[model samples]
Target: MSPRIGYFLSCEEYSPSQLIEQAKLAERAGFEALWISDHFHPWNDAQGNSAYVWGMIGAISQACSLPITTAVTCPILRQHPAIVAQAAATAKVLTNGRFTLGIGTGEALNEHVLGQRWPNTDVRLSMLGEAVDVMRQLWTGESVTHHGDHYTVEDARIYTLPDEPVKVYVSAFGPKALEVAARIGDGLCSTMPEADVVSSFKEKAGPGKPAQVGYKVSYSTDPERALDYAHELWFNEGIPGEAAQVLSSPKHFEQLAPLVTRDAVAGSTVHEADVDKHVAEFAKYADAGYDEVFIADMGPEYEGFFRFYEKDVLPRIRG
Candidate 1:
């Protein structure tokens, strides 16, 4: 089956108003849903914005009817899982159950602001599992007092909750994290178009569990200009491996941004106006068997981006 297409709102690059506007535009353009990044800081200063995601989500719920999911929020640190439970429950109610809580073992870039020691990947994955357990307990609307390895929740109960528990979609890349995700996650969330990963997730997670993937693109009439915009604002996307996860600050990312070349960014992202290229990019996720695919525009040309997808790209993919 062809995957449902959605728009990704880059909170790292767009202001709250811009995100709300994009959400409305995406729905009007025939997009089915929305994915919004949750971040404390932009990857670099060039991207330049990080509004509180929950607050933006509240505003976005009022502005558009499309379902919203945090591309991935880290609940282990910076914010306690108990607090995240309350926030997510409220979001579910605000969206009238059109919300999903997508979570991951977060990055130091966002989690380190509270001065907590950044745990290694294995430890982080363990904490994530416990965090999900904590959140799920609170979502049942019963008072929860969890004294676990990583977290301690005093007598706490979420007063506001939807009719059903908020569905949790886990974001993962490596094997260990994927294992945890399969065990606990209601669905899978990823950015890579790796067929093996999706297949493994389905095999382990069983039927009726959906998987989603998101990718970045730059859209403009002049493809070269689009490449320039992509490199200028999002060159950090080209940074390979664990650097993105361990980097403590936006300045740290900025220092590495110089090493990332235009070709590196161009190679990974579709920075063009060509309909076939955009359709082909979406097809990669569909071929990988993701149930949903989200596309995020890289630069300021988003108005044109929406129009291009509406008139050209979406039809080709759906047709």
Candidate 2:
């Protein structure tokens, strides 16, 4: 298959059943994979929505037939390594061996539950390194016995493991973490979708490791309406905070439709309605040498978005 095309899902959407239906549609639409977000709380005052990620993913497994994994999940702080390993192993089995475990150090908002300490990025990455190490040992059916900077296991073994190794995809933003991904992970995941990032990651990760980037557009027949929703639901992702670290996607506020104001929507997607313009943004990442790009549309114009993507975009770049 050519470099993969995928669909994105937010764990916070209203109708998870609808989300599952969308995944089936994506499979029928020729999408290669599905990436779902992992979140704990929505800060109702801000985004006004948040759904249980693993539960939703379970629904996706039952409702749709597609390869699935979280775009990125924090295994270090939000949950324990053994728990994550067991859950991921089960998911791999449930998905018919089509699951990849994408992980990251994580953001404070999601990790600070139960009053656990939220370390800085460097420390968090260090923790993740050890966490992955622990999970790997457990997944290997080994009676793990180790003491690391952040985690420890005592004769632990996952009773259930997939027949095949569960591909571990790591989310990295900068140089140091990228190097760690190269040395340890099976693949790299990033939101930047910049070619430079992919090349840098591959160099440190060495050859043959998976490198996937995610990008989204507000696809709609009417550019204006899509852009409006982009500002509302998508724009907050652009906000500057610990929350924004995970949501590194950028916005060209000045370049988009000038009329859409800050008050109208949570994001500046008013200009995203133009399918060509929207896909053009995604192409920048593809050109950057990413092996896959997962594009999630913000509004209901999914069919329209898929048509434009398959006809206008895929023909030109997909190999």
Question: TM-score for all predictions?
Answer: 0.99, 0.86
What does the lDDT come to for candidate 2? 0.73
lDDT, model 1: 0.93
Show model 2 residue runs off by greater than 4 Å. Answer: 43-46, 240-273, 300-319
Show where candidate 1 strays beyond 4 Å: none
The lDDT per prediction is: 0.93, 0.73
Residue 135, model 1: Cα distance from true site in angstroms: 0.7
- lDDT string, candidate 1, 1-319, tens digits: 6788999999999998899999999999999999999999999898889999999999999999999989899999998999999999999999999999999998899999988999999999999999999999999999999999999999999999999999999998899999999999999999999999999999999999999999999999998999998998988878899999999999998898779988888788898899989988888889999999999998899999999999998889999
Top lDDT model: 1
In candidate 1 the C-alpha lDDT for residue 289 amounts to 91
